[model samples]
Target: TIAAEGGGGWKEYAGGYSDWANYQASVHQAASDKAKVDVRPAARPVAAAAKAKGDKLSWKEQRELEALPERIAALETEQGQLTTLLEDPAIYQRDAKAAQQAAERLAAIDDELMELLERWETLESRAANQG
Candidate 1:
């Protein structure tokens, strides 16, 4: 005998498996039709504004935007080297003074890197908003 005591055992209560499957299928088809009817085309005013803004950047702003990646890369390389020195056990063991100096330099590099990243993000957001 079919058990109808739990969730999804509604098939037995609905008069059997076939009836339950038909009801679920009809609900799914109706939802799919509603979604298709609600779809919209892209808005034209926003697209035009973005195109116009992209055309309006000053030459210097364009150049700086292009150069930011290379500048960030060089700073990151310097930061990595300083980090290695700070992490080395040999440096700490053989020359405690040098290790401390390396740690201080690493901290300064980290600060500079953070500032550069902030500037880069600001410029990126400005460009996006203008577009």
Candidate 2:
């Protein structure tokens, strides 16, 4: 209720309102974390039974592992180029040399990320249990 100034009652006013919002958040804190949740889209591959998984590498895995040398060589080559560019005398000509340095760092991070990806692929292929 509001009284008008003309009435000389109180001259009260009300005109502020926040957004009316209803939100539901479901936070499922994993209990124990011992149970692995496979939420990814792909169905997990079943690894060989514990007994049958002798140290022998599968044909595909052997191929992938053999390819590691080439992949590592490429990653190392890219990293070396990135380092050389960062150290090159002409690269410091930019107005934001600091930013250039940061860019170089980002490049290094990208190279490392690639290396990690390669390693992960290799390891995934070599999984005793491909699950």
Best prediction by TM-score? 1
Q: Model 1, residue 125: what's the lDDT?
A: 78
In model 2, the runs with Cα more than 4 Å from the true position are 1-54, 95-131
Q: Mind giving the per-residue lDDT tens digits that candidate 2 earns over 73-120?
A: 676676667556544434444533553544445454564556557555
- The worst-scoring run of ten residues by lDDT in candidate 2 lies at 18-27
The all-Cα superposition gives candidate 1 an RMSD in Å to the true structure of 23.6
Each prediction's TM-score versus the true structure: 0.51, 0.38
The lDDT for every candidate, in the order shown, is 0.61, 0.46
lDDT of residue 38 for candidate 2? 30
Which residue window of length 10 is worst by lDDT in model 1? 8-17
Q: Pull out the clashing pairs in model 1.
A: 50-131
**TM-score computed on alpha carbons, candidate 2:** 0.38
